[model samples]
Target: MERWLGLARSLVIYHNPATVRAWRRFYGQILRPGDLVIDVGAHVGTRTRAMRRAGARVVALEPQALFARYLRLTLPRDIVLIEAAAGGAETVARMAVSSRHPTVSSLQAAFVDAAPAAPGFGHVRWDRTEEVRMVTLDGLIARHGVPAYVKIDVEGFEIEVLSGLSRPVPMLSVEYLPGFASLTTRVIARLEELGPYRFNPVVGERSGFLWPDWRDGAAAREWLAGLPADAASGDLFARLP
Candidate 1:
């Protein structure tokens, strides 16, 4: 029952026509027809569908059983669906599950421990655990080939997900929480190690970049560090340019 409520909430928040259209426009600008894209933590498949509409071939990974089931039913047949989590290794991990707000459910223990004190998370709870299979980005790449874009939103596990990739793709994005700014900086450092990448932030669900031009990792870190603790959560987009 609680899981159903959470899924309903996510559908209402993300499946709306305006949000879907915004995502389609955003991906349309980045992807060419037949480009491959990987969506890590594809909860509810909103972005996956949007990328598909933009003419990209998509491979979506969702670890939550309920959400995976939902995606199987709703996502188009052409999009490849993987019912697992992306991590640094190909093993099993226990995921902290938030029955009422599954988007915040995560595999990182520290994130679960610290997020309650962060702004906009006091009401969220991880009341259950599920052992989920994990696959590395390199493994996915071996099977699906290199993607043109990879979108990751695994709560606080961004660093671990990037660790699995031995090489850089053309573009990728990871979620950032203002209160966890240091984690994002570490993510930037990881990206820098893989390739020379420029970054821009997209606050909340807005389809546009926050900067007039893509900035270096240092500039991106500086901007993230300057943000207030209560600032809106968003994705930090990185690309080779």
Candidate 2:
């Protein structure tokens, strides 16, 4: 019940009309009618909502029980909500849960341990844990067909999720924290192995990309490394050559 209430509060916080509009405009540029999108870490389905509004068919993945229940009650019928975490393989895993800010709950134990020292994470705590079934990106593709875009925001577990992917899709995005350069570095390396991919960054929840043009992984890595230690978190966009 406490977790449910926390999730309710998060829905109110994230469902801001102005912010949602910005995301909608950004997503609208990428998703076309009938395009399929995989929304990993679909917490409260805010991004899923934007994707649907942009005319994409969505597969919303949320592992937390409280949020998954909320998604089932609120998400559109056309959007398929999967109650599982996307990881490197099919298995059972433990998730660190933050009842106060459920969006930061993650499957990466190291990230949880390192959170206190990271900017913007000092106030949050992993107060508890829950067991969740884990599925892979490859497994998802096998079941739902390949998605045109996959938006991953599983806290710091982005690399693990990418590990499940054996091939590159047309495009994908993963959340990143400037304080956790190593995490994004590994994510970029994994993507590079699958294909020749260019990268861009969208700092925070803004509608704009950080660079005027897409850059190679090396350039992107340099850019990430140069960010100030206090730089806010954002999503990194990766696209195939």
Candidate 3:
């Protein structure tokens, strides 16, 4: 019952017309017709639908059983839905599940360990664990061709996901919690090692970039460092320049 309520909450929060419109507008600006996109941690497929509406062919990955089943039934026939998690390797990993707040469920134990004390996460609970199949980004590229964009939102496991990619895609975005600034810094460093990339951030669920000009990694780090301790979580976007 609680799990279903959590799912309902997510659907209500993310599937509202305003949020959907924002996502469509955001993706439309970055994606061209017939471009390929990969959406990791697809959750309820709201972003997947938005990306598809932008005329991109999408492959969405969701590991949680409930959401995977939900996506399989709801996502359009054209979007490829994969019931697996993206990780540093093509192997199995244990996922921490938050029955009452599924969005915070994660594959990283360290994330589960630290999240309880985080400003906005004190109410989230990882009440159980489940083993899920994992795929590497390199493996996905080999199977699905190079995507024009990849959006990863695997809680604190962004670094592990990047570890699986040998080369950089044209663009990518990873979720960044202000409370987990160190994790995001490592993610930026990893992208820098892969290629020359500029960074920008989209705060909360808004579709617009926070900065007028994309910043280098150093500037990005400084920006992260300067955010208020209670800042809302957002995604850090990186693109080749």
| Model 2 accuracy (lDDT, Cα) | 0.91
Query: Mind giving the per-residue lDDT tens digits that candidate 2 earns over 32-62?
Result: 8889999999988878998888889999999
| lDDT of candidate 2 at residue 24, scale 0 to 100 | 83
Cα lDDT tens digits, model 1, 77-168, are: 99999999999999999999999999999999999999999999999999999999999999999999999999999999999999999998
- Which pairs clash inside model 2? none
TM-score of each: 0.99, 0.97, 0.98
C-alpha local distance difference test of each model? 0.95, 0.91, 0.93
**TM-score of the candidate numbered 2?**
0.97
**Model 3's lDDT to the true fold?**
0.93
- What is the per-residue lDDT of model 3 for residues 207-228, given as tens digits with 9 covering 90 to 100? 8899999899999999999987
Q: Order candidates by lDDT, high to low.
A: 1, 3, 2
Candidate 1 minimal-lDDT segment of 10 residues: 11-20
Best by TM-score: 1
Candidate 2 segments exceeding 4 Å error: none
Worst 10-residue stretch by lDDT in candidate 3? Answer: 13-22
